[model samples]
Target: MPVKIRLQRHGKKGKPFYWIVAADVRAKRDGRYLEKLGVYNPNTNPATIELNLDGAVDWLQNGAQPTDTARAILSYKGAMYKNHLIGGIRKGALTQEQADEKFNAWVAQKEGQVQGKVQSLAEAQAAAEAKAFEAEKAVNEARIAANAPVVEDAVEDAGETPASEEE
Candidate 1:
């Protein structure tokens, strides 16, 4: 039986979340699946993907073709790269230790990149909030300044003697 790795849509109307599954090629888009491999949440800023790397690679090795979007998700999560390394090891082009080291290094690098993006986003949000606060402060200060002279003039016109004059 021809098998396929695909995404099954599951979230609400506007926000879409997906389940990565291995299913028969003839199965409906969101129907029966042999196994659910992971989840893909695109609602987040970085498009969070939680995948079972081993399961995905196992399906790939067993000749399960991935849909285009599923392929991209697998690639993003390093399943494809891990599979490639496994292929190299099988062909005697690299040792298992070397392949593992490379994969680990790649995962570490990818994690660093994701962290950097998250940090930058937080910094940008803080800067925007600070700018807004400063603008609001300036507006309030201007309003108080504008009202100051008018208040003083009214006090004088109402024949209100200064405390020093009353003394």
Candidate 2:
């Protein structure tokens, strides 16, 4: 059987959630699978992915070909890099310990980048909310100011007598 790694759509319309799986090539897009590897959620700001690194690498080593989108997902989650390191180890180009060290360092760097993006997104959202609030306050103040003179005129008219005063 030709095993393939692919995504299975699972969420509602307009908002998609996916399961990453290893399956037979003849299977339908969302049909039966050999194993569920992980999940991909693109709804979040950073496009959240929860993957089993070991499982994915095992599949890759066992000759599971990934679809393009699944390939990108695997690459994003470091599975492809881990597989590469394993290949290097198998070829004696690098020791297991060295491959582990490199993979760990790469994961740490990727995490830092993701964290930075999340923090920047939060800061931008906060700034936008503050700006909107300030604009709304300015508009309300203008409306009150525009109505103040009319109110004053009404008060003056109420306090003064009619202009028909006697001789």
Candidate 3:
């Protein structure tokens, strides 16, 4: 049986969550799988992916063909890159320790980038909230100012009417 690495649909409609799996090509999309590798959630900002790096690389090396989207996901999570490094190791261009060190450095860099994006998104949301508050404050001040003169005029009229009656 030819094996393929593919995504299995899971979550509710319009909010797709997927399971990355290694399965026989003839198996149903969400049906029997050789191994459950990980998950992908696209609803969240930056799209969330939890993958087993080693498992995915093992499948790739064993000739599991990935679908287009699955390939992108695997590439993003570094399985494809790790497989390449392992290939280099096989050809004597890189040692196992060196390949592992390179993979670790890449993972650390990817994590830093993701964290940076999250931080920027949070800062932008805070700025928008602050701008909205300031606009509301300005509107309230204008309303109070517009009403103040009417209140003063009403008080003066009341004072004049009573004094004129007494006179």
lDDT (Cα atoms) of all candidates against the true structure? 0.96, 0.95, 0.95
Give residue 5's error in model 2 in angstroms: 0.6
Residues 1-167 of candidate 3: C-alpha lDDT, one tens digit per residue: 79999999998888889999999999999999999999999999889999998899999999999999999999898999999999999999999999999999999998899999999999999999999999999999999999999999999999999999998
Candidate 1 TM-score to native: 0.91
In terms of lDDT, the poorest run of 10 residues in model 1 is 157-166
Cα lDDT tens digits, model 1, 35-67, are 999999999988899999999999999999999
Worst 10 residues of 3 by lDDT: 40-49
Clashes per model (N, Cα, C within 3 A): 0, 0, 0
Work out how many backbone clashes candidate 2 has. Answer: 0
Q: Which is better, 1 or 2, measured by TM-score?
A: 2
TM-score of each: 0.91, 0.94, 0.90
Clashing pairs in 1: none
